[model samples]
Structures are given as C-alpha cells and as structure tokens.
Target: MSFINFEILATSIVILCRVVIISLERLFPYNAHQSLLRKGFWNDLGMYTLVQSFVLSQIIFGFAYWLDGITELSSYGLLSSWPIWGQVLLSLVVHDFYIYWFHRWQHHNRYLWRTHEAHHSTEDVDWLSGPRSHSLEILINQTVEFAPLILLGCAPETIAIKGMLDAVWGMYIHSNINIRSGVLQYVINGPEMHRWHHAIDHEAHNMNFGTKFAIWDWIFGTAFFPSGRKPVGYGLGDENFPENYFKQHAWAFRRFRKK
Candidate 1:
C-alpha cells in the first residue's frame, strides 16, 4: 500500500477511536468531571485536523526522502536486516530514546519550554489534547521520531505499522476514560503514569518524559508515579497562556500581551 493509503487507514482508525472513546468517556470516566465538550475542544480539534492532514504528512515524507538521499541508509545499523518486527522494536527504542532527551529539555530549558508550553497549557488531558501542540514542536518531534527509522533502513511497512501503533498509543495515553494497564504500566505508557507527568504539582514536574516506554524514565531516575493519587490539575499555572490557537501559536514570540 502507498503512504496515502496508510494515512487514510490511520485517519479512519483515529476517527473511529475518537467516537468510541468519547462515547465511553461520557458514560464512564476516570474523573467524574470529564465532559464531552470540555475546555479547548475547538482548539484541540484544529490541532488534530492539522496534524492528520495530508499536508503535514507530505512535508514529513519530503524531508525523509531528502535525508535518505544524502545519508543513503546502509546495511549497518543494528536493526538494518533483522525482521520487520525486530526493526520496528529497535526503531521504537531508538526513536523514543531520542525524544526522551528532547522532551526533557523542553521542560528544563527556558526557550524550548516556551515553544512547548502550548501543549502543557492544556488543563485537560484527552485524546485531542495529544495533538494540541505548537506546530514547530510537532515538526521537531516528527523529525526525531522518524529520522532514526529512515536512517536505519527500516522497511516502509514497518514504519507505517509503527506510526499507527504510536498514534493509537498516544490517543490511549491521553484519553480521559482511563484504566490501569497492570504490570504493562511498567512497559507501555498509559494514562495512569502519563497524568502524573502533566501534574501541576512540583514532584511530578520534569519527570516521566517517555513517549512510549517507561524504561527511559526508570533508567534516568526521572520517573514520578505516586500511587493512589491523580494529578488534581495540569498546566504551568500561567494564566497568561492564550486559549485560542492563533494566540497560542504567537505566544512564544509575543512577549507583550496586548491589552
């Protein structure tokens, strides 16, 4: 199948999941305050549409193609010829490892934090919230995530499958309708741990930077999971953060908020 076909299939799955999960969230929720029309609905919808749009995918693919032409993926990387599944497994580990550092710096570094602040401004963590990110940040993230896969010469099929899995896992982690994943929580990233990463509390701050696996946090000693308690809230407690998409986009540059 072509990239377009993969995108269409991914889109259909995402839309279906959103509808199903939203319905379930209304009937049962991890937080009783969960609402179908909660805050930032439109803003998040815009972000989701932008990320899932063909334009974004084309840009990503274009960049990958150019990079591959220069780098010319050789049969060297550890994952180069291992089965597709093995390539995907190693690709994920490598990609997540790269993002882990980037994500951590987005919190620790002042300037990077500004670019990433829009995402954290979300008071509510839901399926849509996963995509409510600054466009530049999204570009950087995709670069780090896919650069390794292309460089490793991973098959296109493996890349597509991994991308779909990543999207589904992202939606799952951000969904409001939550359920613990038992021991899997130690392996797979889930809401139970992810929520704490969004916590307004100091202890939860600057921790749990893993995008898919929790092992990175464990290895780095940055993991924060306080059992029996959920994040009472989210965001940086900055009332200055704009709620609209355009304002949020300009926020990193417009230091002077016009009255």
Candidate 2:
C-alpha cells in the first residue's frame, strides 16, 4: 500500500516536471527547426500515458515484487545499514550499469534491435520520446532493472526516489530544449549526448548508451559528441516504420515476414 502511494507521488512529480520542461521548451527551444509536435507525437504520447498511468505501472511493479518474492530478498546487512540517500544513489549506479549494457545489446543484437527499433523510428526525438517504447521493451526493462534493485536490497522509498529521478531524467535527456550543459554533459547524461544516440547516421547512432550518467559511455568508449552541431535528425531510414502506436509496437517483427 505504501509502495503504491510512493509510485503515485513520485510519478505525479515526474509528470509535473514534464509539464515544466515542455513549457520551457516552447518558450526557448534548442532548435527552431523542430516543431512542438515533431513527427509521431501522438504515438509517443499514447505510450507515455499508458506507462505513466497506474494500470500499467501497477502491473509492472506487481511483477517486480513477485520476482523479488521468488528470490526472497529484502534490505540486508551493509545495504540496510546505509542511509536512505546512499541506498538510492547506489541503486541508481547499479541499475544504470545494467541498463547501459542492456541498451547496448538491443542495438547490437538483431532480435533485440527489433524490439527497440520502434523507439528509433521517430524522426523527432524529444521529452516524450523516452516512453515511446514497445510493450516487450518495457517489460524486459522493468524486470531487468527491478531485479537488481531487489537483489541489492534497496528500500521501497529508495526505489521510488530512483524511479522518480529516472522518469524525470529520462525525459530531460531526450528533450529538445536548448540546454548546453558544457562540461557537465561529460559527468551526467544530457540531451546533447542523447540526441546523438538517436542519430540516423551509423557512426553517431552506436554511441552514448548511458541512461543517467555518461561515465559508463566514457568507460566503454561509446560516447560521441560532435562540436557545433546536433544530429541531422532521427529515425531508422525506413519509411514503413509506421506512425501509429499499435503498429510501431509490432514493427520489429515485419523483418521476419516471408515474402
């Protein structure tokens, strides 16, 4: 019951933050070249609303708790003794490490890439782009990410904090707002680096797999940042990628169709 409350409170904060950022972007966009509804807004919005709502998250969190039950885990020993803030920070680090590699795998493995390609199908990447994902992708991510949080014995409050931060930061990194973080971009993941992740060009597309921090990319040598320019745009170069949420969810399987 408490967990449900945390989910609601934390997510409400994320949505409020999203409204603020979108408002800022409208007033001061990074690129006048992009439109407010930059292609595929409805598709992304559909997924975003679905995931942000209680119904989908309740299912995902309920599943995560079930997985935790299977393992029979809880905050224990050293991790339990740590302050709540420490626990949350460590949880973020561990979770992001898994996410970085998992995200990279999705790009390299053809089968996984099929599940992720819908996210890349959007030509206009921005705040709402983070939630524009396939159902499989969301399920896999929640499970993978949830497993570590449980194994590490993080508190529910800590998980909520990380979840809120992840949601808000996820939107921030994918945003189109004119933010030039300069050296800070090296320390934390920012729109500048993330936009490169969405680049249609192969060279840029393969880089910057980090979710919250750039340290993983810096260590893995996958970070790419060009001086004085943004990505030409975003997408897989497939005109048939589909603009509808339902179709985009299944867009990956089309490759297996027998002619």
lDDT for residue 229 in candidate 1, whole number 0-100:
75
Predicted structure 1, TM vs. truth: 0.86
Give me the runs in candidate 1 sitting further than 4 Å from their true place: 1-8, 51-53, 74-80, 255-259
lDDT of all predictions, in order shown? 0.77, 0.79
* Residue 208, candidate 1: alpha-carbon lDDT: 90
Task: Name the best candidate (by TM-score).
Answer: 2
Residue 209's lDDT within candidate 1 is 89
TM-score of each: 0.86, 0.88
Candidate 2 residue 235 Cα shift, in angstroms, is 1.2
List clashing residue pairs in candidate 2.
none
Worst 10 residues of 1 by lDDT: 46-55
lDDT per residue as tens, model 1, 122-200: 8877776777777778778887777677777777777787777776778777777768677777777877777778789
- List model 2 lDDT by residue over 1-259, tens digit each: 5778877999799889999989978887866677877777765675555643345567777877787678666635336677879988777787789889999999999899987887777788788888877778877887676656666676778778877897799889888888888888888998888888988876797899998999899899999988887677687898877887767766767758656
